[model samples]
Target: MSRDIRIVTEAQLREVVSLDLETVDVIEAAFRALAGGGVVMPPILSMAIEEAHGEVDVKTAYVPGFDGFAIKVSPGFFDNPKIGLPSLNGLMILFSATTGLVETVFLDNGYLTDIRTAAAGAVAARHLAPSDVAVAGVIGTGLQARLQMQAAHLVRPFDRCLVWGRDPARAASCAADIAAATGAQAEVMTCPASLCEQSQLVVTTTPATEPILTAEMLHGGLHVTAMGSDQGGKNELAPQALARADLYACDRVSQCETLGELRAARAAGLMPDTPPELGEIITGMATGRTHDAQITICDLTGTGVQDTAIATHVAARLGGAGTVIPV
Candidate 1:
């Protein structure tokens, strides 16, 4: 007896998928399913290579209703750019839920992860940010900083964008890129505090051990999505900032406590009680932003369910586009 397997390349996946409203909805539904329960997901297995400034993570999840599950291997080599390579790259393997056989191998090289991550940010903003956002800001100049801004725009539709980073030239370039891509007025800010003060929505996309967005920067009618703190020792928001927000949400409470911003908050004794997960809000199991003046924050540590959902979705869309092999 032999089995057939499909191999989908990054190019094929790129042709069929994008960071659009539909993609956002798919990721959002994954969260809803997670909140609904019956989803089997494990904690991420991460390895850090200090000498190389690189890290790799392996994640997998199985949703009850889905026909297939995905196991993803993602690697981030921060110093790759010095040699003209991308900082992030990885692939996903999709397996049949019934037989646990490999159904497809997606050579996406972290493209799907990038999309789902940005889409998750949009989901957070959609439920937490003020209904009317005049200015949106990002606190990094990386690829996620750009994708997150675009993703939020799909849901919040801001009029202006503020960009800030450690490097002035990179920040200016990021602002110009945002302006050109989204046709919105984008400006480079000197500091994160100024950006947060003026923007209704802010996203932190940097991998910094020290806090970049602090408590003093938070204000009424503000929504912050901290997506950079997915590994232990990565702290983006000041611990007290979580306590200050009217509501603070996490993609997954346990994962956040170990790897995300919640870890810092818990260590600082600011968050004693567990906060609501993003999935709870999506499924109405918990409350979201109720008033425009309330300040809300969502801590997103990438989840395995997102990878499974996105991989399943991509496999469906591939639909005979990739090469097939039998074993």
Candidate 2:
């Protein structure tokens, strides 16, 4: 079949934004697809942003079940503010499950990354968060933190949102924006401890090399989503946090343990004896949140399969020849 080549600009992605509920639905469905064994997403490749000299990594997610590959790369540190460039960028590709035709291409790597990660947070919340949860706390005020908050809100109607970051001004601004967007009584607090004390749902999105959240700060039945630990040397939550969790799931156990929050726990020999993938939980091969007071956590370091899933979703939404192109 002959078709005209159509291109979608970043403006198009921005226009076709899936805020909270839509993001949750997309994410849950992606997990469902993955758990069904039709989707194959592999671990992401990433490195810490060096303050002086920047480094990058290339990661790929292949769904052999789906017969496609989604690869990603983080390329820039964007040190010069005068250039007005972003710190992250990449492209996503999708092939036909059967015919192997080029199905789609997502040039907006940063956008795709933020949304997919947020969606994963929602997936975790769906499985781990209490049905009665009303307050949520965010430990970071960056891009990932915003996505995490949005995704968590879709899982439940948050009556309160507590946001705190190293940069007080950024936290205050983010809190104010969240309040207006979700209509939740939001507060820009100091740090994680106070928010942890009051909220049942907590998400840590900081890219910290040192531990930010201590063991004593956590309470029972608190659903924590660890999204920050995506590199070998970086970690936020302490190993004790994992020791206390009743149920723990990750996008990919191998990847998470090597680079994500699991890295910290495993280093201290405090990692779970039995850990399951998110697909296992989504497919009912495993269980999540059996009791009301059980602590649960999902280590989401990001996956290539999700990047593929979201890329496919975007291509489907943007019709015409947005994906099929001659190289």
Candidate 3:
């Protein structure tokens, strides 16, 4: 191989890695890899600044059979919108699996993260949610909230979607954008409970410090995908909501215990009995929803396996575009 690293910008990556069914399949396979112990992943290195309302996380994993691994740095500053900036930004570095040489540097500025996360949500829904979803719901008006719905449609096409946000104006805007993009009727919901009552699949994408989706809001045949809590203090689902679910799975049990919704549930003395990992379900090691009325929950704390899988997929797509880098 020649000695030249391929540097991809966010715009370039947008041309390749889109939020579609293909990406969702890739993320699903990554979870299966995690379940089979085919990847070497470490706990996320996370830091939070309470005063600034910001957090930074570093995650990476090496799938032994894959050609490359990705180290991702993701930062979230909740105050950025006030300064006319996006709330999330970061990048990833791809290294060769064999030589550990830098093969690609994706200056995606969190675009890949956004793609993989949305795709992960869709994957979770595909495996855990009901086969036929009439109505979909999103809790939050942020980018992930919109992306989650878009991605979910790739698997279970919903008739319409409901969006709820603290700011009604933002929620309306979100509904408009989603409607324009997917040609689906979108409306602003008054509360999370109302949305849950009407929708079978609901995704929570808020950086909330308090629980947003509680047990009283959930009913039979409902599936919840909680993707917001990636740090210790961030939580979106009430402990009772999880404890009441028929099937409660997480991307990673270890990470969920410390950083995902499970952490909050445990702290509240509401731990579910023998919760399985989402990977286990993906790999068929565990059952997902056995009955139509069974309530299911998928806690996605964001995993390095997702980064590795996406980065590897992107690199393969860039086969002719990427130059060989020497060790």
- Candidate 3 positional error at 132, Å: 0.8
| Among all candidates shown, the one with the greatest lDDT | 1
Per-residue lDDT for 92 in model 2? 58
The TM-score values for the models, in the order shown, are 0.98, 0.89, 0.95
State the weakest 10-residue window (summed lDDT) of model 2. 318-327
- Give the clashing pairs for model 3: none
The global C-alpha lDDT for each of the candidates, from Candidate 1 onward, is: 0.94, 0.76, 0.91
lDDT of 2 by residue, 1-327 (tens): 764334555557766757567766766766766666745544455565668356576666556444455566656465744467666666655566676666555667568778888888988888888877889999989877877887788777799999989999999988888787778888998768999889889999987899888788877878888889877988988898888778878887778889888888988988757588887887788888888787888888877667666766676667453444555
User: How does residue 308 of candidate 3 score in lDDT?
Assistant: 94
Ranking by TM-score: 1, 3, 2
lDDT string, candidate 1, 1-327, tens digits: 987899988999999999999999999999998998999998898899989999999999999899899999999998999999998999999999999999999899899999999999999999999999999999999889999999999998888999999999999999988888778899999989999999999999999999998999999999999999998889999999999999999999989999999999899988999899999998899999999999999999989999889988888888679999998
Cα RMSD for candidates in order: 1.0, 2.7, 1.9
TM-score quality measure for candidate 1: 0.98
Candidate 3 deviation (Cα RMSD): 1.9
Instruction: State the lDDT at 45 in candidate 1.
Output: 88
Residues 169-241, model 3: lDDT tens digits: 9999999988887778999999999999999999999989999999999999899999999888889999988
- Which regions of candidate 2 deviate over 4 angstroms? 1-6, 38-52, 64-68, 76-83, 99-103, 321-327
Report the Cα lDDT for residue 166, model 3.
100
Model 2 lDDT vs. the true structure?
A: 0.76
